[model samples]
Target: LAQRSKAKDWTRLIYSTALSPHQIVRGEPNAADREKDEENDDDFFTLKKATDVDADSMDATKETYPSDQLTKWDNEEMFDSIRNLFITGRNDP
Candidate 1:
């Protein structure tokens, strides 16, 4: 879950940087982008360092599961997985 969250954060960051005002105005990332990039660089390094610690902590807390098990899931299981992906408690309205 932590890794998934990080991946989502990275996706958001990339899209945000790609669509920033400087990129729209200059048709390319430039000096203004550099400022935001520097901030993201700091975040990257911080996330990298934290990942090392998180990896160790997660290993101690989470149970190991076989990756191949997903491939063996039945139709019902696959449907449940797809449903879970599209429907979350947070999106309820």
Candidate 2:
């Protein structure tokens, strides 16, 4: 039937449009093209590289705590509590 053939044609069009590459669908330049343009424009910008002195100052300023001073949780117990709450639909275990 003509209606069935039209439905099939529309289905094919929808699928092909969905599955096609983004650039093809949108008629835009792909990532490779943009990357090529970026490569060409790299000379226009100046990038600052971190010096050894900066790195050393950053490392010297960090504070560290002892392992025993940090709060610890039993992961298995926490997971079981959460699972029970979800299964029972109750806030308290």
Candidate 3:
């Protein structure tokens, strides 16, 4: 589950990378559209996700997404990924 969440985060980054100059710079979602967006919750990528599958049956799967699985990005590898990204819930880098 933890890994899925990680991948899910990365997937959002990948999708955000696609935008026309006009769409990105001048076209923005209006308040109503934004409110509607808040109501939509779909996972387009199966990357590190915070969701669980069936807990029974042969196809049942369990997933967990605690922050302790990986080292903090405050180290070298993270560099400045946060500056370009809007990560939430983290008290620190």
Candidate 4:
């Protein structure tokens, strides 16, 4: 990690190709393979557009964090007790 961080062009060292165990253990890129990889530079770092994942049927806001618990409690004193557990509420001056 340290060596990669110090490198001038650290991103060039990164390759997304899958390798077999034997190839990994050998730990060397053949000249022909290296040339081929260099030729197809655009294929390596190209990013695809993300698909819209939302179903659009459900109400996203209410589904995320239901405010029912906060509304039901409705007590400032109860909240004060919970707040004192944190550093901001520490009274030990």
Candidate 5:
């Protein structure tokens, strides 16, 4: 039931995105049909101001547990029992 609900939500999201005004209109200017009285004015308009952003502020660092404190999953008996689960194991059920 949860999977169906999630699938429905995803389908709705995709459908809405595909049919949205942004996707339909695309790069066409919104005011293209406006009066051309200002055609002599050649001033260009930008949606956003261009600025140099600090690259150092975007660096991401991850904190990791020390090797000595890491959890180990090596067990001889368990390895022998589940060896078939590995990729190279025999394809028997």
Candidate 6:
């Protein structure tokens, strides 16, 4: 990974054509093989520099955490009670 970082213009977005060991052993050809035949091989791995985060879909591919007002239960309060079970015990007087 460090060696790839040395390249100044190296882009962060990455596209990879990877195959499982089983996929390779079964002689099932994939984009990797076609890439090799086309002289686009990069040390047996076909990787492309991605320009956009969601190039094809271009839709919002992110999720936002629930806001305080939207949350049903207070997470901190629940954890506090669970933690108390280890430090304090309930008994009948």
Which one wins on TM-score? 4
- Candidate 1 wrongly placed segments (more than 4 Å): 1-26, 44-93
TM-score of every candidate: 0.18, 0.19, 0.19, 0.22, 0.18, 0.17
Q: Candidate 4, which segments miss by more than 4 Å at Cα? A: 1-63, 91-93
Q: Is candidate 4 or candidate 5 better by lDDT?
A: 4
Q: For residues 1-93, write the lDDT of model 6, one tens digit per residue.
A: 456445523232222335444443343456876676588543578567443235465456695666864463567765455553563644321
Candidate number with greatest lDDT: 4
lDDT of 1: 0.52
What lDDT would candidate 6 get against the real structure? 0.50
Model 3 ranges with Cα > 4 A deviation: 1-19, 24-26, 42-93
Which digits, one per residue and each the tens of the lDDT, describe model 2 over residues 1-93? 455454444455556665444334344456886687677666866455333254445535677877653433455565565564576656666
Any idea what lDDT model 4 has?
A: 0.56
Q: After superposition, how far is residue 40 of candidate 4 from its true place, in Å?
A: 62
Q: Higher-lDDT candidate among 3 and 4?
A: 4
- Candidate 5, residues 1-93, lDDT tens digits: the string is 455454444455556555454334343234643334255345576334333355565555876787654434365565566668888887673
Worst 10 residues of 6 by lDDT: 8-17
lDDT of each: 0.52, 0.54, 0.51, 0.56, 0.50, 0.50
Please, what are the lDDT tens digits per residue for candidate 1 over residues 14-42? 56665654334334455875686568775
lDDT of 6 at 42: 38
User: What digit string (tens of lDDT, one per residue) describes model 4 on residues 1-93?
Assistant: 455345534233235545543454454468997786566676766445333344665545654447976674577766676676788887653
lDDT of 6 at 77: 69
Clashing pairs in 1: none
